[model samples]
Target: MPKKRILHGRIVLKDDIISGYLEVENGKITGISLAKPAISTETEFFDYGSQYIFPGFIDAHVHSFSNPDEGFEATSIGAAVGGVTTFVDMPYDRPHPIDNAAQFNQKAAKIAGHSVVDIALWGTIPKVDGVSEIPGLVKAGAAAFKMSTFETDPFRFPKISDVDIYNSLALLKHSKIITAFHSENNEMIVELIRRLKEADKVYPRAHMMSRPIIVETTAVQRLCEIAKWTGGKLHIVHVSAPETVDIIEAYRQQGVDVTCETCYQYLLLDVHDLERMGPRAKMNPPLREPETVSGLWQRLAAGKINYITSDHVPWPAEAKQKGDQNIFLAPSGLPGIELLVLAMFDAGVATGKLSPQVFAQLLATNVAARFGFKNKGQIVLGKDADFAIIDPSQTTTITDAGLHTRTDAITPLAGKTLAGQVTATWLRGRPIYQRGQVVAPMDYGEFVPGAEFGNQLAPGGDGLVFEA
Candidate 1:
């Protein structure tokens, strides 16, 4: 057995945030005890004083290869600095979309030696003949599978009909896998955008006007109906409105077996910011009114929302520089992988809007449990030694120069001051980020798939449900 070192600090575990000591041996937790002087003469030790030690966060929904300029390393560095130990990236527009087992393995081989932290991939299950690839892809280590209910590009994201959706779900019935849906009625939005553009009202507001609350609510309602009809596990990715959460809560009350997540942008920013930032704030399912933000916080406080992810998609300003033309031409997504954890801690914990347990549940535990990552999410003895030392009193202003991502676009929270900051992060008891810089091994991550709870979603199936 390897020798142990005692780390003393203000520790934040699953349901308790207390000042204590933690022992680590061979990159795993050994014990949690009250703070005291060392008994063994040869014992090694590190003290964090008053800093808060929290389990490293996991980004459940992210686009690893979305931004052209912000390549893999940039995103990884940003993630590390943000105290994220594992990133579950979607496989939508990569050079090789996950169509077959061969292509899935090819992409896995590409990311095998590139990441600095743990990674899980979301495979694309095309609505065509590619339905047969689900089992093989899962066996080959796909983190989850994603499909759009709306129409998408022919080769990239093929939309599936209701019959095809059920067919794919039936094939994956025994696999106990998670099926994530984009959750928008494509034909409705397409027609709305067409009419708005023809009427010469294609502004940023028009984008929101095109995809109304009914667009998302109707899709979510349909997904719940499908889940009730078929017992397939489903996850709704990147929810935008308060009404959506109400619907999800109601579904859970009715016992629907669904798990859903909302992004940081939806919780923090509002529609007024979009008017000022223009294309910078123009993301899919545009930000809603301030009352919606309040409703989301209430749900978050009540433990109704499952996870909080960054959905970190960073497109350079040059790529989204067409704000003058139609807003439809502008690319969606914003950069926040480096600031998500800090923002959540400050807004959720410091403000007293959420309990520390809710913070952990939304940021870590629920994500790990929902996705089936056996070694991640918790600070338990048998789990992976992934943690971050946070200084809640330290304040910083968000700015472009302070970021670590490859893209040059500014953060939406730029100029806003936030309390609490991540001082260091550890993966498997080895330091990956310290003193605001990355220090982890470069080739240090592996892919996880179809873990134990892969098919066992939350109890009251509340949220969008897609079969495949």
Candidate 2:
């Protein structure tokens, strides 16, 4: 690629946004200039009068599973339109799950040209006995491994046993790969549902009441114990309850290798939203009450939350309405890839709960460092020149037309106007999403192979990974 320069913008740096221009060469940031430069023909330039340039957001949790209506292309379109240049996709795909080397390779090959932005894949153990296949999955280039304590599907998304959890942790110990989990006690949820059904009780609120605080706190507690026992690097995902945050923070203080991420919905919306939205707002680790919401916001400001994501699963309107009268019959999860960055910005930073810098860390920096994306998550010199141009002066009202998900375009964030507007998104110094369309080709995305696998572990490869 030829040299390129992005001129006359407010650049978001480590501590704060600065008035400056940037130079890129070979798809990496090579220099930063604080002063306005005279126009030159040495390089092509994309001029931004006064837009805010933020490190292109990286949503660490998303799903492009083999849904009939939505997959790599649809999700990538939503991602690009939403200003996300990079995302980590979950491993639950239809017909085939990514649990072994062959399956992983096949999925990687399938998504090769279908994405419009950079992507990373999360590998999962498809079944209880699948832990033995982690080595091959890792060797085939999985960025991280994901699992759930509660079963959504027996073979596709099973509740991993304690023995398997210990075994997975042991296998990944010192590997630098973080084993991520959807932490919630299976039996507790099952028994709660059984009791609710037997008592002839059913309501939207029953979903929240069934998975009480203990359900998540208990699973988080168990995960911490297993991780400590096996010396594994663990990450708890979609932590809705503040109790889970308290648990992970306390465990980290004790020196166990641990980290956790709260979903964007957890911080921005609550039980009332769920009650009003029903299956449309349904998700694992159900939304909490008002008081819990207040407490979570406080913790979010305190920096107890390591990062945030949109466990982005876009179920169709019919699928959500299938349960109809019964909340139990309705599937869990919702679409948020197009809403995450803006939602967080509107709720956190613009509202004074998060400083501009901290918000950037949550969406980008912390995630890159936690996982092993060596060149991502920051706007530093030599880093990949991925960025989202923000027009802070602009505000947008959420609507079906404004959204890019393949299914129901209406989101929990609909109706309300948000403060920041993403005008353009660039990946590796090249434009991917610009002026509300994907300018980059389907094959523009490159699979980032796991840096820990091949060359790193061969010969003088340093095995010291996941230390942070």
TM-score of each: 0.92, 0.95
- Highest TM-score, which number? 2
Instruction: Candidate 1: list runs displaced more than 4 Å.
Output: 1-3, 37-44, 452-468
Report the lDDT of model 2 for residue 121.
Answer: 87
Candidate 1: residue 381 Cα off by (Å): 1.1
Model 2 regions lying over 4 Å from their true place? 407-409, 455-468
Tell me which residue pairs clash in candidate 2. Answer: none
Q: Clashes in model 1: which pairs?
A: 176-455, 256-461, 257-460, 257-461, 258-461, 258-462
Compose the digit string of candidate 1's lDDT tens values, residues 304-398. Answer: 78999987887777767777477888888888777788888878888988776677778889998887788889888878888878888897678
Weakest lDDT window of 10 consecutive positions for candidate 1: 453-462
